[model samples]
Target: MDEMTWLDYLPVLGQGAWVTVQLTVWSTLFGALLAFAAGLGKLARNAAVRGLSVAYIEIFRGTSLLVQLFWLYFALPLVGQAIGINLRLPPVTAGILALSLNIGAYGAEVVRGAVQAVTRQQYEAARALNFTPRQTLFRIALPQAIPEMMPPFDNLAIQNLKDTALVSLISLADLAMRAEQLRNYTQDSTTIYTLVLLMYFGMALVLTAFMRGLSSMVGRWRPAQR
Candidate 1:
């Protein structure tokens, strides 16, 4: 085979990059949702709700993300078969699920910490105003806590983006997988890996900028709630 040039490699890699972007976007969105749910649940007055939230956070945080991906993509189907159910998920679906769940567990701790850091005086003031628990949380606590959460959440978002590379192991055809395929065919390890690294860095920069802008917006909004 003739040696492939950068021109030929780029388009194929671009396709793979698109897939990676999609996975990152979906996983981050879902993970944020899960983080809030689990975080708030942990703070709930109800014991059962708190226990379940703690269990979910612990299970995901304590385990390896790679193992989580493998179990979701491989073991789940067999477990389903034993129960006469189809628990198999598509590679992309499985990838997103594992990534979101893992990141969510970590983000939950960030959420919990930020919320807890809100001063006791704030809660007392809310109570003085005859605010209900739900009203105080949404109106007072979250408005303060959410801004604090953004920096850590930004880190988690970037980490989630990098973690999406692991999906290539499950044949998801992400950027890493495409780069690996190209390397196997061309044996151009240095060039191929370098391009992949640069591409990931570029994506990370973009994600970071977006997250910072979001954080700024939240910071501005927090004062308005006062």
Candidate 2:
């Protein structure tokens, strides 16, 4: 077989990278939303709300994301058939759902911890201003806690990006999957894997820079000064 140039494999890998990026972006967005909702739930006055949130976090955190992905893509269809319901998910949908749920579980802990770390003085001040618990949480506690949350959130975001590779196992055509295909076809495992590894590293660096900028902005956001 003739030695294929890197250029020969670039297009296919580029397409795969696009899918991976989309998965990472969408999953992170949804996951963050879930994180906030569940985090707040953990602190809710209602026992039922707190119980439900704890259950969700524990269930997802306890399971492997790969198994979650498979359950959604493969097992759900069978379960649906048994129940006479169409619960089948497209590969991309399943991938995004699994990634979002998995990361959201872990992220909820970050959210909870950061919010809880807010000083008692801040809460007392909010109360002195006649703020309800909800108002205090949203307006005062959150604003102060957000910056503290950023570093952990940034780490979780990077982890979420790497986890997108698991979707490739379900045939979602992500970067890792594309690299595997190219390696099999060209029999250049070293070259294909090295490039794939570099691509992932480049993405991580870019994400780190973006997170740093966001963290800086958050750190500078002083409501009192405004």
Candidate 3:
């Protein structure tokens, strides 16, 4: 094999970075949905709903993300066959699902905590106005509680970006996977790995900045919007 310059690897890595970005964006959006749903479900008045939400949160949070990825990518297929169903997911899908579920579990707690932190007086005021529970939660409580969720949501967003590296192990051709491929071909382990590390750091910094902006916007929310 011929020796190649770092510039030659950029194109390859860029492609991988694009995939990583896509994974992060899609997973974060979907995961936020799950987080909100599970979080609110935990606060639901019905015993069954609360139990289901608690189970999902505990199961995902308690397990290793790596293990969760492996189960989805590897074990689920076999389990599906045993049940006469198709459980095989493409690497991309599995990666996105696992990352979302894992992060959503943690995000659920952040949501729960933020919502619970809302003052009881707000609810009481809603009650005095004869507002239903749903209206009170949707209007009076969430407009305030959502701001509190921003800081922690930012943290989780960054964490999810880093977690994308694990997806490369499942052969998703993300930045880390591209680095490994280059290192194997060129045998330039140090330079290749260093570049990969820098790429990840750069992505993380960008994500953090974006989340900070979002948090600032959220912070500016007025009760008048409610």
Local accuracy of candidate 3 as per-residue lDDT tens digits, 1-226? 6669988899999999999999999889988999999999999999999999999999999999999999999999999999999999999999999999999999999989999999999899999999999999998888888888988998999889899999988999998899889987899988788888898889989999998788778778555433
The residue-level lDDT of candidate 2 at 8 comes to 84
User: Which residue pairs in model 1 clash with each other?
Assistant: none
Instruction: Kindly provide the TM-score of model 3 when superposed on the true structure, using C-alpha atoms.
Output: 0.96
**TM-scores for all predictions:** 0.97, 0.95, 0.96
Which regions of candidate 1 are displaced past 4 Å? 221-226
Off by over 4 Å in 2: 1-3, 222-226
Candidate 3, residue 118: how far the Cα is off, in Å: 0.3
Best candidate according to lDDT: 1
CA lDDT, every prediction? Answer: 0.96, 0.92, 0.92
Q: Write the per-residue lDDT of candidate 2 for residues 164-187, one digit (tens) a residue.
A: 999999999999899989988998
CA-only RMSD, every prediction: 2.2, 2.6, 2.6
lDDT for each residue of candidate 1 in 102-204, tens digit (9 for 90 to 100): 9999999999999999999999999999999999999999999999999999999999999999999999999999999999999988888899999999999
Compute the lDDT for candidate 1. 0.96
